[model samples]
Target: MTTASSTSSESSQERYQHALMNTFGAPKLILTRGQGARVWDEDGKEYVDLLGGIAVNALGHGHPALVKAVAEQLSTLGHISNFFASGPQIQLAEKLISLLQPASGVGSRPAKVFFTNSGTEANEAAFKLTRRTGRTHLVAMKSSFHGRTMGALALTSKEAYRAPFEPLPGDVTFVEYGDAAALAAAVTDETAAIVVEPLQGEAGVVVPPADFLAKARAIADEHGALLWLDEVQTGMGRTGAWFAHTASGATPDIVTLAKGLGGGFPIGACIGLGDAADLLQRGNHGSTFAGNPPACAAALAVIATIETEGLLERATMVGEKLRDGLAADPRVTAVTGEGLLIGVVTTVDTAKIAAAALAQGFIVNNATPDRIRLAPPLVLTDEDVAAFLAAWPTILDAAEALA
Candidate 1:
């Protein structure tokens, strides 16, 4: 029997229906276990996790260091309120400061970080910080997915998602992404910030032009607006580097991150550099779980593992193979993105392709009707890449037939 079929056979679907909320739709599968870049359904069938828990699991499931760090830290000190800071918190803040100022205007200015429990919360904090700029108007790009919170949602451009949560924190403008002209036209002296994603993830791995970020920086500087890059989906070595904006050499006023930050342990941060650092005064923001020691320890472990294991270079090499291999198929019209974050295009529906892959023991996401996104772990080996490449044509063939 198929893995998915056997999972359904073994799990008590009724229990989930009775216990869980209707949000997030029905359970995709009763996942029982995971290790490395693969996971097992309750029925003991395994599949490669190419999506990496929506790009959250940087080291994949059950990395020794990550597991031990969380276990040891939690045992040492479970949860300390933000009222008192821990060693891990201070260490992580220092690490982020060093990472954020790779090459700065004045030899990497001192920065401050505000922690949060998730990407959305990190963004919400940054949103509030922008308000402390004493301006209300903010601008964001089309097809960008920031977060679900009302403040972040106001900056996100999807009409379908935002309409339901209408009357969100207002005075936000939506402009065409990758179009420098539109961005220049939007920003004014009254604008608080111009938030952007270095590489649009939910928009099907859409990468803007190399100079687009530099252009945004110029406009933000011209208008005295804070240039914020929502690195939630694209930061922390996901793009084969520390931060996606680093390559552009644009020192953003604010940078918000999550997803791969804690390597799946649930930690997010909003980093403000230079003058932007002190905008949010005392009592500006707070979170119960934000700089808790355990989470900070988890994030530190992820950063250490990436450095010790050389996963950043590994990601670049493996991603090149995956990108080139997927593009070889005639069915795939185009391929875009760097590192493990990839988006594949084809004439067929991405939903059908995703379904076909799932039936064949591969998990992926249909980012759009015609685009499939692949964000496997940075630790994905050459063998894993080979296995997926071998399975690619078949997956596409089945998708074509289904379509």
Candidate 2:
């Protein structure tokens, strides 16, 4: 085992470049520890984490509830195979189904969940479930990202990600996102499923027209195709709702979730409602560690914490302030999204803006060349938002100058 003293002199960047694959290019920072919405680097430099682990840290880093749940569950039972059921796993599933109720908040549909270990894996499970529909064709939206796994990759519309990984699962079609007419035209009777993100997170938090999701639901119904919403990035109270589609008034047959579900722990779920629930047979899919006690406990704690802390209302309130503050600067052309998942449209290079923000002791993401995305922790305080707002103009100025 390598001790801290053994590698203290070497730079993490140099060590990362030497030991790890270059898939993500270079290391940004070697973080040592985190608490609430703030993290410290190896050098003890603290930065407000505006990205929130790409919207995964729902309750922020090292929340006591999440930590305690994971610890206690692991101490009790860590890994029981799927052959036997566990309390946390069952409870988490029931909780997720309950949260999938329609906007009316009346009653929820009967839904069954298949757990996985990440957002991509959840999408992969949903993809396989669609194939079990006996229709091979799938309709996806352009400028959409599902995951890197082969099945999920086939459903993703970006050519850059698909170019090298040719021979992806076949019969996948890409349609213009937010264009209901195009979606309707593309989805046919032969289509097994129409997979979409409630709001395109990687495509710079792009939200569709209010009626677009409803239209998709109608089109899918017409074609006998399942409507699958990828809520991996937009669900679990990130959008100030349990799920983003609830606000759109679209009741989907299937929903894939991850990211904030387990807070910081890795867990995902492919939830199928109504008849869609029975598509996958017993042996069709299984995971060794998908619904393990620790992950499920962590997720339950996150949900409990959100309820007790009133983070959903807080997310909406803070998000409004953030969006308004970001748009106050002339450099920001537009801002979109709900809750903590905000997108800042800029005329200048967003990559430079990200760098400027980092230099100023903040961490955010450049989702695209012109779009800066902020998916801060749900627990982010008013003071944190104020700090970012205070530095927004200066950060933009430095970025604009660099551009």
Candidate 3:
């Protein structure tokens, strides 16, 4: 049985390599099943998934609520064109608008939402919406990552991702991240918008200064540029809050979301608040299958599950435990980020560390050469954290020796 399974897995991998585009490079494991924070490979080896599909699986795999919601929605009405609306779509849009409300107790500001299939698409939609401002100039931060699509890629600071696809959308300025002065200097009256991630996730869960978002809000207000916060990774209770920028009391004009929003389902949202809400008028934007019923239902289920399961508070508690435990290791130089969105800087090569972690039945991401990022499921249990902590030293030792 084992030999047959191995042969089948290998055959399938070869078929995949031959058939699919080489964009992702290679497959790490042939995942067969998952429940909660654990997953099983084709060989039936169980591993703790600390990366959560790059922070996508908030409720984790095979979550009954998510599965049921999607199933029921599909059975009732799977999809409809953007010209028509569904109950799930309207409900999700309203839910997201309520969630995007700032926590500062300010008067309610009306917001509108545009749904998309993924984070990059959400960013692309927002990018086009910015152009509706009649100003082409935009400002983004260095080392920041918004998405990979051409429009989103234009705002991303990494040259490697941009170089191959250059002559990207122009009229964008990249300024040093976390540098308020640089941001202020870059944003001018002609700038349409300023895009930033409340916490940089792909650049290894980098958190900005406490006042960074506030300063950005002030700067955008001063320059008449829309303040766009990309919360695809840090929003939807991932950071123990509805949104990361809310913690800084910064109310952004535009917000993009995805990743964990659907608890693994493909759904993204671009929100516009206040006067910005009306910028993208009719005929300005459209998506064929953006707010299909099943996807919207799945997202609503994830949000409901998060609220009912009290995962937000749990994320904070477990995150502190993991952060403190990981930092205790002398080899771990620093720990950053809040809640489950964590990044660990190591003295050893992160690739080796990731390999060692896999050997120890753990799933983590080497987000950068020196940073190991962990965006585990919000429902991560105390037992899982304890097990990872117990094995941390051994993983490091093996990685160090391998390095």
Candidate 4:
């Protein structure tokens, strides 16, 4: 059996296909290294990264702050089991609680945090917390993406992702997103929680009505159901705010965060506010590597850097430029989203646009057949934006020709 290292003669794509599972399909590029918003392939070709690791690279690749914090924390103290908590873990938890203060508005009610290794795990923790309400029914928005885990999948609204794994846990009701009336119709007193993504990311960065979240809050309150906001993709300054729902001023009982929380490191959090905070008592849930020191330190560093560098304002500024430039093109039908999480609806198939982007030394995501989503690193420079904008017309032209 030839190991990957021993088969140096084979192309990186060939090696990847032989070694990895077929879950994500074929490898698009064999990336070797990255700096800021740019990445280099194994063959040394460079491309501007517009997708930002699917909105995970908040500070961009190889950020000094993230690197330093992880290294220092690992050298000082690494993984510690849940039996004993570390400073970084405790501090990160505190930090998250503080950030959610404005969005929670629980008054004297305290918030509690449960750490996880990924967004799905965080959502899983939140799901279990909802079960503690003594109700098995849940209401989730249509086209909403929470995660891929069994429990999280039960909350997700995509049929393609949930069909093969039928009989998912819980009795979940799906309602039309952005439709407050539909949501009200679905959620009942028996419903334990109403899970929604303030801005639907996987559904091509769909932005609901301005008052949708506030309406969801009222509806949940009317039925005595907890309001769970899944901010896995839009949280942690991805939308120019600590959480995307902050602007809506809708207080939530539960908030799940990940993606940019750890910059590029793997870390997530499940926060329960007010009465929901006490739902998951001891022994209800546990994880082996949920709050490791290195990951927590990385998260802390990411948050600190965001505040110090003013990336929230930067995300808004850069996002505006990208949206305005893209919308100016006749090929683009509409542009939606906030800050760096942008969606471009094209007149042609986005698959062609994505292929054309890659060929033209840019990385973008064809989130759907007709929509292209851009969640670039908040650190994407003016030069990088200019370069992409300069080549935008040609990329569209190539895509149009293919169409």
Best by TM-score: 3
Off by over 4 Å in 4: 1-10
Candidate 3 lDDT over residue span 36-108, tens digit each: 9999998788999999999999999989999999999998998788878999999999999887875522358
lDDT of 2: 0.92
Model 4: per-residue Cα lDDT over 277-368, one tens digit each = 89999899999999999999999999999999999999999999999999999988999999999999989789999999999999999999
Cα lDDT listed for each candidate? 0.90, 0.92, 0.92, 0.93
**What lDDT score goes with residue 253 in model 4?**
95
Give the C-alpha miss distance for residue 235 in model 4, angstroms. 0.3
Sort the candidates on lDDT, descending order: 4, 3, 2, 1
TM-score, model 1 to reference: 0.97
**Per-residue error (Å), model 1, residue 52:** 0.3
Q: Candidate 1 regions off by >4 Å?
A: 1-11, 103-106
Candidate 1: 10-residue stretch with minimal lDDT: 101-110
Candidate 2 lDDT, tens digit per residue, 1-403? 7657436525677788899999999878888899999998876778999999999999998899999999999899999998899999999999888888554142656789999999999999999999888999999999999999999999888889999999998699898899999898898999999999989999999999999999999999999999999999999999998888887788888999999999989999999998888999989999899999999999999999999999999999999999999999988899999999999999989999999999999999999999999999999999999999999999988887884
Itemize residue pairs with steric clashes in candidate 4.
none
Considering TM-score, which of the candidate structures 2 and 3 is the better prediction for this target? 3
Residue clash pairs of candidate 3: none
